[model samples]
Structure formats: structure tokens, C-alpha cells
Target: MSMPTLSAQEISSGRVVLRKAHDADRSGIIELFTDPVVRTYLGGPRPRRDVESHLDTSGIENATAKPGSYVIARNGTDRLIGTLMLARRPADRPGHVTDDRDELELSYTLRREEWGAGLAFEAAMAALRAAAAELPDQPILVVTQTANQRSLALSDRLGFRHVCVFEEFGAQQSLSVARLHSFAS
Candidate 1:
């Protein structure tokens, strides 16, 4: 099912605005996905050539039409810093917390230069707020590599409780969940 587009202003925090990705953001997206430091926890960086080829062909419209996908950009300059998504966990995936087996999952990544400034946290909270509005009582999940300290810490800060640990892609993954009540605050 297709998701609605979010109003950038409605979900913005102090410095970050959550909105759809644009053609102009391709370069930034390419940069974020190709940076070794940024991709360290999410899987190693993709080849620059590969990223270029994909962006050059598939484009941003396909990526933005999905319900909860967003670009985390600076408010005034509108500089792309990261991406955030609250999507359904595939029924076939390892983490299944609800009977439907399609629980919402929160995923985010910030450019390396944007790290240490809380943009990820701010953008994530904004995205979760938007998700809570649509999903109401449904819980949102996040799966991160156990070794990704930054993401683990962010999940804790966002009030996601650890559900379980399982292996995926040859690495230990921590599946965490945050209920609607947690987002109420």
C-alpha cells in the first residue's frame, strides 16, 4: 500500500525538517550511502559507481512515494543530512512482534558530518510522531546490528525496549520496539 506524503513543517524539530527526497538530494544521498564512516554500522559503504548508476537511473520519486520515507534536511539551507523511514517489517524477516508479522520498523541514517549533533534523534522523533498519528496504537520496531553503539544508544533514548537478539546477514542483530505510549511523551 502507498503511504501519504508528510508535510515537512508539520514534523520538523528545532533544526531538522523531515520531508520527501528530491532530485537535488541524489548527490547527498549518494554521499551518505558511500561514506565509509556513515555506512560502518549499516553494512559497509556501497561502491560509488553503483550508487551513481542507481541514482542516475531509478531517481528519487520512487523512493519518496512510500509513506514514511523522509529526508532529514537543515531548515533554512535545506541541506540534506540524512534519511528516515518507518516501514513495515517484511513478514519473512526475522523480527516479528505482532500477529500480523508486518510491524512498523523505524530506520535512519545521518551523514557523518551531521553526527554528534543530535540530528538523527531529532529527525527520528519527528518521524515517529508522524507514524504515531497514522498507526495509532501500533508499535514501531528497529533492528540494528548489536555492535552499532550509536544506534543502540539512540534506540534506548527513544524508549524502544529490547525485544530479542538474532542473527541476520552473518551478524548479531538487536530487535527493539517502541509502543505508542512511549511516543505520547
Candidate 2:
């Protein structure tokens, strides 16, 4: 079965569109993840096969089986400029078993040329707003490498408070979590 492509509203800046990713977007998505700067923060380049496999796994056809995730900052021509993923922890996981619906993890990336333009911040805020409307009681969490000042700053500007710093993938990193209740209200 094919996944449905969801259309997201334009953020205040109006330069970006957060929408469901299509299987055809696999190549673009792979480029976004493969950029050296992006890899610096995201860990490293995913093996080509791994990226291919994940794109297949994340195809829109699987929407009903998973939390909402999307390609962010799609241009007017529908080119993917960035990506955002929002998902509740799996029900079988320890965290989800306690509070499944009220919390979600957020991950995003944008082309280097798009950085410093506030597009990432705009997209993230818009996503949070959408999530708040769709899941009013849920909170959003953003985890990133401590060295990723760009993302960390964006998170802070968007109201994500610092929660902790820990090691992930064998590297010391910062973990920030935010509650969306205030934004919703």
C-alpha cells in the first residue's frame, strides 16, 4: 500500500512547506543527510544501502503505522530543502509505556545554503504548532550534539529548555526537551 502525502501549512515566513515525504524523494533526502556539515552534527554518512532501506521504511504508505514525520522546507517547485521527523516513542519502549501520547522526539535538517536564514527555526516552530494542534497534550523533545550550536540555538529560541548532556553514539552530547502545552495555550 502507498502512504498518503500530507500537506502542511506554510509557516509565517511562507518560504517553506512541511509535507509528507514521497518515495521519490529518497535521493534528495539522502543528499541532505550526506552533506558534510550535516553529517558533522548528525554523526556520519549513512551507508547508501541504509539510506535506501530507511526511505523504503519511511514511505508515506506507512503513515497509519507510525507517528507523523515529514520532509520540511519543500520549495514552491516541491524540491526538498530540509526534513523534520516527529514521533512518539514506540509503545513497547520503556518511555512510551509510561507516557505514550504526550511526548515526541523531533529531528530536522536543512541544506547549508538555507542555514542562518531562520528557515530551520521557522519550520520547527511551525511543526511544533501543528503538533500542538494535533496532539494538544503532547510535549516535544529535541536531542542534538552538544557541538551543534546552530541547532541548540534554534531550540533555545523556540523555547526548548536544556534537559541534560549525555553521551550518545560514544560522543558527549546535549539533550534538550520541551513541553508544548504553553505554546498551545
Candidate 3:
């Protein structure tokens, strides 16, 4: 089944426009991943071919088949300032009976220059809003290296509670999770 196309808005921050990524955003996305500061938190600069592969594999057409994903704040000029992904929990092992599909994993990276500008928080909040509306019943999660102070701070600011610590990708990591409760009433 095809997913609905998400609408992108020009979110204003004084004079900046934080919107979604588009077809012409490849080069800007590549630059964000290649920056040293960004690579420090995320493993390393992913190979160019690998990035190209990701773009091809996770395009808008595949958004519904998997958990939704998006690029960072874009302007009317079509510049990419960050990236984010929300993936559904994987299926259980063959013999395991416990599988929670109502959970999603999130990861994001922003241009080094944009650090501390609140763009990351803005982008994350946008994703959370979209997910709550589009994928109800699922809680959102963010796992980061324990030493990644920036991400840990962002998680705390966004209301993700620390749940556990685990080792993964050869590094000690903290797993945080949060529920999306409706406060509309």
C-alpha cells in the first residue's frame, strides 16, 4: 500500500525555514554526513555509495512499507540542514513470542554548524508529531552512545526517559523511550 505524502512547511525561526528534504537534497545530505562533528557521534562518515544506497532504498515510495523517515529542516531554497529516521521494531526471533510492533526507533544528525541552534529539537518535535498522528499506539525511542552528551541532553529535553544501558556497535549505549500521550482534551 502507498503511504500519504507528508506535507512540508516553512517553519520560521526568526528567519530560518525548517522543512522536509526533497529530491534535490542529495548533495547537502552528503555534506552533513561527511562533517567531522556529525561523524564523531554517528560511527563515521558513511561511504558515498552507502549513502546513495540509503537514498535509493528509503525514498518516499518506501515510506509506508517501513517506519517513516525524513530529512532535516529545509528552506524555500531547498537546502538540507539535518536528517532523521523512525524505524519500527524488528520482528521477533523465530521461537520468541514477544514482539512489540508498537514501538519505533529514531536517529538524527544535523550539520555541525547548526549545533546548539535548537534545529535538532525542532526537527525531532516535528517527527514526533507526525508519528503520533500517522502511527498511533507506538512509543518512540532513541538510543545513543553513553558518551554522546549532546544527544543525551536532547533526549532529556524532548522528554525521553532513560530506560537502560546496553553495549552495542562496540560502544556503551543508553536506550531511552517515551510514550506519545494525547493532551488535546
| Superposition error at 92 for model 2 (Å) | 9.1
Better of 1 and 2 by TM-score: 1
Candidate 2 stretches greater than 4 Å from native: 1-13, 49-65, 90-102
Model 2, residue 54: what's the lDDT? Answer: 68
Best of the candidates, lDDT: 1
Candidate 2 overall Cα lDDT vs. reference? 0.67
lDDT by residue (1-185, candidate 3, tens digit) is 22232233333433234455566676777677666678886787877787778878887333223335566655455567777766654444111112443356767888888888887887777666665655444456788999999999999998888987877677888878887543011
Give the clash total for candidate 2.
3
Q: Candidate 1, residues 1-185: lDDT per residue as tens digits?
A: 52333334336778998887888898899898899998887789999999888877888765566777888899989999998887778888798788778777889989888888888999888777766665557778899999999999999998899999999988999999988646754
Q: Model 1: residues >4 Å from true position, as ranges? A: 1-10
User: TM-scores of the models, in the given order?
Assistant: 0.91, 0.76, 0.73
